[model samples]
Target chain A: MKRTLRKARLLLGVTYAEMMEYRAELYLWALSGIMPFILMGLWAKAAGETPMGMPPVDFVRYFLAVFVVRQMTMVWVVWDFEYDVVNGQLSPRLLHPLNPVWRYVASHVGERFSRIPFVTALMGIFFLLYPKAWWVPAPGTLALAILAMLVAFIMRFVMQYAFAMLAFWTERANAIEDLWFTLYLFLSGYIAPLEMFPPAVREATLYTPFPYLVYVPAKLLAGQPVPALTTGFLVTLAWGLVFLALQQVLWRTGLRRYSAMGA
Target chain B: MHGEHYVPEPMPSLNGSRYAVAWRRFWLSSLAAEAEYRLNFILATTNSLLALAGSIFGLHLFFRTGYRLGGWSWEEALLVMGVFTLLDGFASALLNPNLNRIVSHIRDGTMDFILLKPMDSQFWVSARHFSLWGVPNVLFGLITLGYAGKKLGFGWTEWAQGSLPVALAVLILYSLWFALAATSVWFVKIYNVTFVLRSFLEAGRFPISAFPQPSRFFFTFILPVAFLTTVPAESMLGRTGAGNVAWAGVTAILLLLLSRWFWRFSLRFYTSASS
Candidate 1:
């Protein structure tokens, strides 16, 4: 266990240094997530003109929370993995003592660390622009929200990594992810809050994994009520486990096909 | 000793006809190159359709609450969405595939060869390649416009009126994208800077007036996103005054000129790779 911990530490430290070298690019990536803020403006304006069950300020806060959650939970494993698989770069990594997936995880963790200052700076600018939306959550609620955010990040990472497994068979695996992202964009509360969704649509969307990715944690972070917190956590874990099992199966079978390519 | 008296020949002038021929060759070659990816075309079409459906569904949520966004009716807002999709298609087809390569050119020193060419560097870089993937979005946008226009009782005259602003919107968008992409001359590693502009342009999916006062100001003056889709939609609906269309024309011209000037200024800072 101690040796494994040491290895992880070394991997993360090296990757973190690599990520820090591209500080300006990382900041631009952070800035590219301003879609939530733009939507916040539209939602807030609409909510003011009508009774949308939440006030305009709540919409602002909700989307700010969404921006934070999105930044923390973003995953692009499919793009990287597809490039590696297609370029035969994975051949070298296969000989490593640890699973190659750990390398991706280490890099993602490193990027998240490098991105913290930029995200904080963006949040500061947001509050400076609209200070009326600022509020602190209770300590208990903050703790629960942090835990939910972490789970949401892990769940998203594992799910995309499973999708990345398809690169073993096809060169266009990222296209599939792009199609899935279209659905995620709409159903994941990236465009609007769940409360604004029609009753029937909201009920139906809750059954999908999309809402748990953004809505659950974002609501908690905004200090809004999440109808069934425990159930949300359970569903998230269930989906994560399903993907984890699928990834393992795909990895074993894919390695055979991968070697047939003379890698 | 003879090399000292060598007079450099005057280069051929780049007239309009020459530019037309060059653009045709550029697009034809790119299309031939892209024709190999049959599966990508199908996938791109499906992605565009799904994205359009989702956008309509999201817009429907607001109108279902008996609340109009920025006082725009459902059909009126659909016009805005249609315009936004059309511009997005144009970007994918031309601006994205071409301007996105500016960073790589600067990085790998291929830009040196580009500069050594006889033709205009800006024109060559901006019009070198086109992708076929965005054709579906263009068709879908036109279909949506027709459906919405029919519902709103729009005639050909209305369409003609709207075409001017729509064309200007394209010019404005191309200028914004090219200016952002040219920043690679200084910040070579910031390939995703155009993505920041793209996220800001997402606001064009809705009417500019739909945002709050401060946001509306920012979109209007800072980004000029108001001229992109909202003005065109309003012109189509006959809700905009002549003044607004005139202002949009002025903005488009000014922005286009500004982008050209900015490109020239940034080239002074372009120290070629390995120099």
Candidate 2:
């Protein structure tokens, strides 16, 4: 574990330097999550007279919280993983003493950390433009949201990694990711808060991993009513375990198939 | 690369007289190349259809919560989305595929070779690599637009009146995209700006008035996404004013000239990799 942590530190440093080298690209990528801001405007306008049990101001705050929560939980490791698998880049990593997953985890975490300052600057500018949307959550709720966001990040990462492993079997793995992204955009508190969803759809979405990734965390941050913090944590943990197990099975089978194919 | 097959023929003059024929040959070559990847074509078509479904479902859910979004009825919003999909299809089919080539050329300094060619470099880089697979997206967009127009009782008169502004809107979009791509000359790492542009383009999926007060103008003038999708939809619905069409035309001309000037200016600073 100590060695793993040490390697993670080194990987994080290298990734930070590499990310800085393409600072313009990194900045644009960070800003690409602006969909929430756009949706916020649409919803806020629709809720001009309180359309879905929430007023326009409430929509503003909810989407602002959702934007920050999303930035914190965003993951794109599947694309990288797909590239590595297809290009035979994973073979060298497999020989490393440390697990290759840790390298990805470190890189993603590093990128997230690098984005903090940019988002902070953006939030500052955003608050200037719409100060009414800025409100402090309760201290306890803030802590809970942070924990939920960490869990959400892990769940998303593992789920994406499992999906990326499908690249070992199919060339159209990114297409599958694109499909998942479409679903997530609607179901994952992106288009609107989950509370705004019809009760039947809301109940069904709670059973899926999409809400845990964005909705639950944003809900926690907004200090809205939730399905109990413990319940969310447990559900997220269960999903993470399922995805990890899936990854293990796929990784083993994929590796064998990969070797057979002479990669 | 398949580009080797495109050998320049002997010409009488070097005043870019061969541009039309060259573009046609390149388009045919691209179509032939993409024909080899049958599965990729199928997947691309599936992705486009899936995207159309997602947009429809999202609009369904949005309208379910309220009768209208930002004063536009559900059908009007659908029309905006249809226009957006049509323009986005044009981007993928014509503009975006060449964007990747431009970035690589800038990065590896192969842009100099293209510049040395007798043909216009900007035209060459911008018009090359026609994505035949994305043609279905255009068809899909037209079908969606037709469906929405049918629901709204729109007829040929509305379309005929809207055609000029729509054509100008397309020109404005292409010029804006060219200016964005030309930034790679000075900023070699602007490849991901395409993603940013796509995000900005997504704002066109709805009426510009649907955005916040401050951003309505931002999308209208600064980025001009309003002209790209919203104005076209309004023209189709007969909601557009004569002044709006005039403004759209002026913006298209100014942006086209500005991009041309910028492309020429940036070429002076481009130091070739071979040098």
Candidate 3:
């Protein structure tokens, strides 16, 4: 186990370095991924005085927090999978000793490093854009927010990876992506708080993994301590494990149906 | 073989004489191609319908909770959404098919052929690609707009007063589409600029009044989403004030001239990616 973990770290580092080769393109990719900021402005306006139970500052605080969390959570695995699988670039990834998921995650997180400047600039812009948000997360909650971000990354990665893996069976992965994006728009608080959903929708969304991916961390960053940070973390961790297992099953299942054609 | 292979038969200067025929030929061929895959086309149309429904779902969720969106009555809001959808469908159906190809043309170097053409290249490129697929969305927007008109119960006079604003809205919409399409010069990786453009366009779905005043001022005056939806819709439903229609004409002219100048400027970068 120790040897595998060490090997995994080395492999991860190498794959990340490969992605850094496209550092300039990667930063633009991350900045371009952040369309949620525009939506956040609109929602913040609607929440004037009080937005769906969040006070005015909380509205500012929640969305700005969301801007950062959503940026961090976004993964472009669908585009990657479509480009590779549709174009027959999967053979090399398949031949690697490590799990293909690791290679994929490594490239993704490696690309995230290029995004640091953009994220910092975005936070600075948001602060300048809204100077009245008087609350800040405690150090402890900030720690939990960071942890939730990690869990959220792995969990959302698995979910998007699974969605992309469907390209093995169908060519319309982007159209499929559109459907999932529609769900994320409402369920994940990309547009509005999950709290603002009609009670039934909100209730159903909370019990699922979607909020853990974005909204939970947004809440934590906004200093709205969820009932237990531990609960959110454990839930995300559990979902991550479940998806990890499910991904293994999917990998085996999908590979059996796979036929190789050289690009 | 290299020089002569697949050479076109030169016909009488390739002038205006054959242009209309070529136009007819293009549409006829496209229609034939679309007819061959009727089922796929149907499914794609259904998906766009689903997307339109999703936008409606957003307005529904909001109005289910509140009566007015940014001082818009429910009826007026629907009309704004309807106008937004109409302008959007028109822009996508008409302009995008022609202009969206510019990025690929730049990347692949095929745009040189366009540059060599005698006619206005931008006009040729912008109008050449008719989206037969966009017909459904156009029909869908018309249906929604019709419904909203019925709900509003406006007579011919209102629509008469509304015509200038509507035309101005369409002009501004086209100009904005052209401006974004023009940005392909600086950014080769601009295949998705329209995606970001459309995301901002979604703001027009709700009244600008629905946002705070600062946001309202920016998206409306600067970004001019205000000209796209709220201005025209308000002309029909609310007061046909001097403020709305006057700015509509002025902004439309400014945007058109500026987009034309921008397109000309970007053309300098067109060293033709193709040999």
Candidate 4:
């Protein structure tokens, strides 16, 4: 375990340097997370005085927290994995001792590390522009929020990796990803806070994995009373394990088929 | 082979019948190629419908709380979304496929084939591919617009006034896309700039009044998304005057000219990777 950890650390350092080479693209990718900020404007205006149980200040704080979390959590691994599988790029990694998933994990985490400084700078600008919109949560809530976000990140990665494995069977993995994205857009506090969703829709989504990926973490960070945070954490962990199992099955079957085809 | 390729054919000009025939052949071939993947076509149509449904749901959520989206009624918001969908469909069908093509052509040095041709390089690169798949999105947008128009009780007179501004907005949009894609001649690695442009355009999914006052000015003049989507919807609703339509027409002409100048200037700097 210690050896694996050391190898992972070295791999992460290399990926971080490579990502720094394309710093401009990375910044532009981060700028794409501005959907939350754009929606914040309309929502704040609509919530003129405490509509949907959230005041305008709370709405601002929630969305700003959401902006920070989304930048950290988003992974483009599905596209990368699909392209590699189709192009036979996975053959080289299969020859190595380390699992290819670990390399992907390293690169993703490395990117997250590289983006922290930029996100912090953007946060500084945000606070400078809207002084009253900023909120500093209490220590306990902040700790919980961090834990939830870490779990959320892992859950999302595993789920997306499983989705990408479908490329082994068909060429339309991206179309499937697009469908998933449409669902995530509505259910994950993207269009609006989950609280703003109609009662039936909110209740239905709580049973799914979508809210835990974004809304739960953002709400906890904003110091809102997440009455189901305990349940949410457990459910998120369970979904991660489920997706991890699915990925293992699909990878094994796919490797068998790929080798049979001499690819 | 080289001599034959270099010989100029006896054609009238770039806009001759031969070129039109070639264009028709390309579209027909593209249609046949895309037809082979039936499931994929269905999936594409379903995906666009899902997106349309998502936007409608967003409008529902906003109005269910009994709060106006910046003083616009539910139908007005739907109209704005309809206009956005219409223009966005046209962009996906026509503009987006060429964006990735031009970026890759420059990066991989495949642009030499295009530059060597006798036709205008800009025109050839931009019109080589069309996504017939985006037809469903255009149809859905029209359906939404029709539904909203019925609710608002729009008359033919209103439609006539709306057509002028909408036409000008289309001109400005095409020029804006041209300028963005032309920038790739210098900034070769910015393949995903279209996604950035898409984000900018997404703001047009709602009315300009939904934004704050300062952002209203920014969207109207600086980025011009308000002019692209919202102005036409307001024109249809009879809320805009003739003067606003005239201003939009002027902006369209100026932007079109600027884009032409920028494209020519950028072409001079493009050093083909193959040579």
DockQ of each: 0.78, 0.56, 0.31, 0.61
TM-scores across all candidates?
A: 0.95, 0.93, 0.85, 0.94
lDDT of 3 at A212: 80
Q: Rank the candidates by lDDT, best first.
A: 1, 4, 2, 3
Per-residue lDDT value at A7 in model 2? 74
Q: lDDT of model 3 at residue A34?
A: 46
Clashing pairs in 4: none
Note the chain A TM-score of all models in turn.
Answer: 0.97, 0.93, 0.84, 0.95
Give, for candidate 2 chain B, the lowest lDDT window spanning 10 residues: B8-17
Cα-based lDDT at residue B92, candidate 1 = 91
**Candidate number achieving the greatest lDDT relative to the actual structure:** 1
Global lDDT of each model? 0.90, 0.82, 0.74, 0.83
Q: What is the interface RMSD of candidate 4, in Å?
A: 1.6
List model 3 lDDT by residue over A122-187, tens digit each.
Answer: 677767866777466899989988988888887878877877877777665655566666666656
Model 4 CA deviation exceeding 4 Å by range:
A259-262, B1-19
Angstrom error at residue A68, model 3: 1.1
Q: Which segments of model 3 are wrong by more than 4 Å? A: A1-36, A49-52, A225-250, A260-263, B1-50, B60-67, B91-98, B130-136, B156-164, B189-192
Encode model 4's per-residue lDDT on B14-69: one tens digit a residue.
57776786677667777887778788778888888988998898878878888888
Off by over 4 Å in 1: A259-263, B1-14
